[model samples]
Target: MNLDPPISSSEVTLERLDPLSAAAARPVTTGAALLALVLPPLTLLSRGHEVTQPLWLIVSYAALGGAAWLLLDRSRSTRPVWTAPSAQVFQVLLMVMLVTAAAATAGANDLVRDDWAPLVVGVLLVASTPYRPAREILFWTIVHTLLCAALGVIQAPSAITDVPALTLAVTGSFSIAVMGFAAAAYARSLTSSTQLWHDRAWQSAAAAALEHRSGVARSVQQRRVSLLNREVVPYLQRVVNADGIGDDDREEARRLARSIRTLLVSDVEKTWAQLMLDDLVGRHPRLNITAVADDPDDLGRRAVLERRTLLRALAAISVERLSATGLALRLSTPEGRLAVRWEVATPRPLPDAHRELRSMLELIRGLTLRSSVHELPGRLVIEFEYGY
Candidate 1:
């Protein structure tokens, strides 16, 4: 019999978490929320005599970018304020950065210059939408950088920039710098997202592999049991019949054949039991071996009884290769005058019994588990007197 492992509970839980779902559900961080506290005032600073120089404007925008980055990085931490209210505030601050950056680039210095506000607001709106926000962020970042490009294109159709007061070289250099920052941020987001997907994929693949191995193990056990029942026992029965016997010895020969069949069944059962134990341990390599109970009875009343019923019933059912699920067993302990009921839960609910033959067969199987299958809200429940 082949022995493998089962999937771990942690693996199952991780599959349920669904990284794509989390990423989709997560909120987007906007430029407005993060830069609101810093950039609006910077606009005022730019309006007054203090911030007229293009170099100073560049430095101001760079500082705003740095501050937004800091807030975003800090938000990633497992802090309480990273949840909602704080997140909203941070988004607003980022929006301010977007507005200020756009105005600074457009060379519109009015204190309440609403002309470029639409462009700034548009960038923020795109940045704040969830589901592939990285892509959206990248798009807006490039759009802003392209605005700088368009400005340069307008100036330098003949050369580079027409602003003789400022070097075209300087404009070109800053434009490159803006585009570089956008590219870098987009690359970072893509890298982070790819790594996240890889991690989840690896985990899911490992879980699927474990499940496959478990199936293989169960299949091997079933096949081994089948060989003993269908081939080995029948072959021995034939052998016993072939041994020529007088009429007086015929009964003895039949009894001896039955004994051999019993021995074969015992051997198969032992092999199956070993395979199950091996899988239980193999699947959970880290499970404390010393703590695991060998006897099914030691697993507690519910577990032990269920395990016993499952093993015996499975062994019997395997001979027939039954496809049934949701089996219920009702046990009657006549000596104690106690009745118990139980049913099996399966992924797919079994059909209702219509024929007497089918019902009798099901009843016989339930007698093995001391339980029976209830059709609706399908379950197998075993009910019995506690003392029994």
Candidate 2:
């Protein structure tokens, strides 16, 4: 439950906690994107006569198209979690389209009450709530809201209006403020719900572990059996089914036996992370997995269980994916921060492997303090630094 790099006043990502909410938002996002594509241009067509500068309107709709494309693009579809960089980009693009749309009639007309910019921005923000933290959404909302008012003021100089510029500004930004606040509130609600669910789940698990220790032991044994079934049992069954043992069978048998040996024998002093890597080494013994631990515990402050989930993901991509390659894992505690350094030697790196690696890491980037990926000659290096 003690996750590092926590979201604003929340346990972690809304996407991680309430994936159903995140998945549900996508259809709404697509709808909003289509609105962006359809609504503004139609509004411009009706009010096209009052335009002082036609070029600005053209630029505005072009930016609108960009924002729509940003939403529709499936480049990041493979990633399991929401990514901040892309979401922030979408916000920026949206603002650009809105501001330019405002600029089309900057000094000649009253700010259009039916401005699609602010409305679409708000709707999109709501759609993004499940993917982004409330604090981040609110920050961008406030900034854009101010810009909305500023647009009103800029247009008020020559445009005939019954109300004061301040009133106009406030009135102009009313929809944005309302919708932005709504999105932020929804985001907070999602975070709270996800946190409560996690706390309850963890408490139930703890109570069960304490009250029924034997059940927990049996569950662990079942998992161990499942692990053997994936590799060892398959090779054994193949040997029994085949006419005789070939060189390939013998090599596979040796590998599976090494995995069993590695699982059965464990150093009491080693951390769970170390044991995990040992298991990986057993599975892929051809990879000369050299591991060195500076301090016994990976994170001296957090519980071993707290760090396992993230580290397991780290190990999967960094160590488990490669085969017959020399890998080195270095775990050190520098300045009370957990720093993990891993390098897997792949003599011939696959095409676009770096992109695939980066996309994979994006799923866990929210959990770690910082991460860096370097594709060196004959090796792929990844480093993760965790905070308390």
lDDT of each: 0.40, 0.66
Q: What is the lDDT of candidate 1?
A: 0.40
Error of 2 at 325 (Å): 20
Residue 369 displacement (Å), model 1:
43
The lDDT leader among the candidates is 2
lDDT of 1 by residue, 262-375 (tens): 755754554333444444434445533211112322222223333333444442342223323333334333443334344444333344322212433333332221333244
Score candidate 1 by TM-score against the native.
0.29
Candidate 1 — which residues are off by over 4 angstroms?
1-32, 36-38, 45-140, 149-388
Report how far residue 268 has shifted in candidate 1, in Å.
22
lDDT: worst 10-residue window of model 2: 74-83
Largest TM-score belongs to which candidate?
2
